[model samples]
Target chain A: MALKGWKELEPGVVILEPGNTIEYKSGTWRTFRPVIDMEKCIHCMICWIYCPDSCIMVKDSKLVGFDYEHCKGCGICAHECPKEAITMIEEAKAKAEEAK
Target chain B: MVEAMVKKPIVKALEGDKAVTEAIRQINPDVMAAYPVTPQTEIVMEFAELVAEGLVDTEYIRVESEHAAMSSCIGAASAGARAMTATCGPGLALMWETLWVTSGLRCPIVMAVVNRSLSAPLNILTDQTDMMGSRDSGWVQIYAENHQEVYDNFIQAVRIAEHPDVMLPIMCGHAGFVLGHTLGRVEVLPDEVVRKFVGEYKPLYSILDIEHPKTIGAYDHWDYFFEHRRQLFEAINNVLRVIPEIAQEYGKISGRYYGLVESYRLDDAEVAILIIGSGAGACREAVDAMRQKGVKAGMLKVRCFRPFPADEIVKALKGKKAVAAMDRCECFGGEGGPLFIEACSAFFNRGLPMKMIDYFYGLGGRDTVPSEFCDIFRELFQIAETDKIKPPLVRYLAVRE
Candidate 1:
């Protein structure tokens, strides 16, 4: 629901809740997704540092996978991967491959 | 609050820019970010000197551009800090985008704008062009006629902008060279008095409150945009009542009362001219000169341009035979200058009957002498007697053909 008046605004429109952008579902905007090859991965964490969307997920002191729900697939992660362990895959092909 | 004891200000001779700096020193804001531009350069410079001398404690950041200056103020203001900045003419033009950003976000940042003419021929003179350009940027605009008012208004602005009902930024406008460079007497209040009067700023949402973290300037599409704009309108409209109340409170201490409009000898007058800023001083003289000749002439100086005192103006000019609106800038392709259009609208909305004329004077800092004001009153008198305005109701005063 949209705010209808000044009563709805937090004076000066300062958003009262933070880190809720995860609800926006920016992954729906991606035309391509990055796939990581675990064999060649060195876990340099460069992708974690360079992601513009901050959608890279790392758990238990290791790079697991991208948070596809929020990532826009800007390819910065693949480009920044020092070991060339990541590859760009078309979203349509990735979805079909997932079915197999 | 009793009327028995009131503190009067100590008088001192200071230039217009110095007076504003003196005001800022008394307020002692949390953050001040600014880029130096001429006419207003001295204000930032003096403020910096105060910072260096340990006379005031403030986080002063010298930004690279006017845009960044205002951007820094917005950032500081968003964090529940009292923030302010100053600029003029071209510098203000550079800050155009962020001006809307500051106002749209409802940041209560105060700006001291030394009014100057915009350049095509590269003139660095004084006029109302810069301030008029931002008429709709959602900031409350207050014009000061002299050095004292410049100091007084800046102090009052701190309260007005932070008022809960009117949480909008304020622009304290001083005519460049006219008041900015001239030296005059200004009353300086005690530092404690100003601090008490302004009180502490309390933002409705503080970005620094990590316990309830928040974001500002988030994206909003059509559905929410109109409502947010409506908030700005309601906030500024509240200024019509809030400003006078604040001024009256200020009057109790300083003995100087400010109002939305200042009418001089307008009661029972047949013809009058509406003016703004320092030019009103000359028009007042003209009104007195005309009175010597038994020509019922008067003057009305618009002290508050934004949230304009439309109803008061209509009441002041009602039943008057003729009125002339004098402007310092030209609104090309418009019906008349900015003030002219606004004044006419005020009357037309109320369906009041009166003959009105528009005149553009003092462009690029051209001097408008008393003789010119007398001529305008003469033409207004003719309109009053004949009930007919001279053709081309708008004319440029003291301009070469």
Candidate 2:
């Protein structure tokens, strides 16, 4: 998105539009990404409860995957997981592996 | 601008604080939140009595402190209510942080600041230090020379602050004891006339409107902080044009006129004195006395200080041999006082080669007599005649040696 000039901004920068925070991608600040192993996963939904950014995806009351777009990858879900189904990986290593 | 006067003013002798309270009674704002402080105490006290009498349907909130007073005003104003508050000296200091917040949120809250000195020995009297300290807090500042001007300034302040081009807070400042405690004849307009004059306050955006909800006081970081502040700068500058137009409209109803700066005998004069607030009265007297002695003396009273009125001030002082900027507050460790610094910049910007000096007086409620001002004019004349500026450009006036 293009930045606004001073003339284009509103007086006092009052946000006229609600829910504008979604425009900012917090995922850009991530240093580590969380990966889940489905073979070792239990449907206890501990990761869903522990994910601070609500990045844990759920479907039909079942654990699915992670929402990477908004996740900051704090590793809270991996730390709180009871079944040891999730692991934290460095984002640089993950991107390098993907590039291969 | 000519409209037939349909209503006659009510002539009454009232104290300055009472005169302002009467104006507030006529304005009848939607909400008032204030905590008491001397000189300014009478305004809130009398207005509270009016609220008890049910003369105005305003929600008067007796807050715990000046900080809360300004905070409550911000909330009320954000919710689309006409809000007002008053304070002085330490009270103004306590609300210093919130003052920026009020202006940052663009709340058109009108406040009557009875100018008083800040405490060291804890004195209660008249000075400009209080408001001068907050001069850069992004509020439109208007100084009054007497009781009537304070009354009139408050009425005009409502329109100026709420103007769509200029959605900013305004401070109508008068000297603490000089105008706030003194009795003077103030001609007040009819209540209906004032009501009609100020009209209805239509907020551009209200937080209370659920149908079109808007967020105020949101956080802005490096990406947009500069832009938001730039808008504030533009809005305050817009007041430079809006003030004269509103003052002209106000003059049509009341027989008195106002401007950004009032010039007394500046035309065709070689020497002049620039001042603000109630001190202008003594300066005017000194100017008149100097004229009797065949001296080319004049006075420039700056009613609007925030915008600084640089162009208008330069124009007024143009072709003059010498001028002095009299300030009631000390700048301390700086080159000179705030007004002096600003006047110097104005002259320097225009490349005007006029002899200028800085005078500090009336700090901590000290009396600045007409003779003191006459002494300043005498020194200015010598500067004009010699064309040789003296050392120690900034001098203390009316202080024990």
Candidate 3:
């Protein structure tokens, strides 16, 4: 989003739109990204339940993938996975592999 | 407009505290959260009795501390309620942190600050040290000269604070003991007239609105904090224009006019005194006495302090030969008091070379007689005649050498 001038800002900086935090992409603050191993076969949805930012995606009561746009890359989901089905990878390494 | 012209005022003898209480009764705000502090206690106490009697449908919260008092007012105001509170001296000090938060969040809360001396020496008396301390906290500040102004300013404060152009909190201050404890004649408007004048408080945004959920006091990082704070600056500057318009509207209903700076016999005077709050009455008396004695003396009373009324003040003092800015409180290590410094700065900014000086008096509630003001006027004449300003630009008035 483009930065607003002083006159364009609302009085008191009140957020008029609900759930506008999605506009602020906190994923940019992530030093590490969580990679889930769906093949490990536990769709218990523990990562979905433990993701603090609600970044874990789930459909039909089964875990799908991570919504990295809003994820702050806190390792809570990877640590909470009882089946060890998630791993925290450095963001730079993940991007390097993606580039390759 | 026609109805307001025909509306009659109810004349009553009441102390300044009671006068404010009467105005609050008429405003009948939605919420009042206050704690007891000397000089300011009577206002809330009387209003609480009225609340118990069901005179006004207001939720009066007896907060434990002044901090909590202001905090609760902020909460209620942000929730789209017309909220108010009263405090003085140490109580104002206690509410220091919340004062900034109140304006920063743009909650139009009105607070009656009975001016009193700060502690350490520990005195419960009339002085402007308390409100002057919070002058830069982004709240609109209006001072009253007597019981009538105390009553009138309180009513006007409601509209000024809640104005859409200035969604900022305000502090209406009156001298603690001088006005708060003494009886004076005040002509109050009928309850319905006041109610109609202030009208309904329509908040820009309310937390209670479920259909359009809005977040109040959200965190703003570096990317937007500067812009938001700049908006607050613009809002307060808007007050400089909004106050006079509202005051004019209030004048039509009450038959009492108010301005940012009240110029008394200032047009043809060669020497003048600039003061604020209750001292203005005494200064005016001195100005009248000087005129009777064939001396060209005048006075300017600053009713609104926060917006400073720099242009109006400069215009008022433009042709004067000499002027004195009398302060009830000292600025300690600074060259002069807040009012004096601001006045000098205003004159300097305009490149007006009129001789200006500072006078400190009535700090711990010492009486400032009309004769003492005459002494200041006499000194002004001396400066004007000789064109020589002595050293030690700040003089102590009525203080034992």
lDDT winner among the candidates?
3
Candidate 2: residue pairs that collide: none
In order, the Cα lDDT scores of the candidates are: 0.89, 0.90, 0.91
TM-score of 2: 0.91
- Report the Cα lDDT for candidate 3: 0.91
The C-alpha TM-scores of every prediction are 0.91, 0.91, 0.93
> What is the per-residue lDDT of model 3 for residues B1-401, given as tens digits with 9 covering 90 to 100?
53554465578999999999999999999999999899988999999999999999999999999999999998898888999999999999999999999999999999999999998798999899999999999999999999999999999999999899999999999999899999999998888889999999999888998999988888888999889888888899989999999999988888888999999999999999999999998888999999999999999999999988999999999989999998887578888999989999998998888799999889989989899999989988889889999877998987666
Which candidate model has the greater lDDT, 1 or 2?
2
Query: What DockQ number belongs to candidate 3?
Result: 0.76
DockQ of each: 0.58, 0.70, 0.76
Tell me the lDDT of model 1 at B383.
Answer: 90
Task: Mark the 10 consecutive residues where model 2 chain B has the least summed lDDT.
Answer: B1-10
lDDT of candidate 2 over B280-354, digit per residue (tens) = 998889889989999889999999998889999999999888899999986789898999999999989888887
In model 1, pairs of residues that clash are none
Candidate 1: tens digits of C-alpha lDDT, residues B222-260 = 767777888898999999999999999999878889999
Best by TM-score: 3
Native-referenced TM-scores of chain A, all candidate models: 0.83, 0.80, 0.89
On DockQ, the candidate that comes out on top is 3
Candidate 3 — which residues are off by over 4 angstroms?
A: A30-41, A73-75, A78-100, B1-8
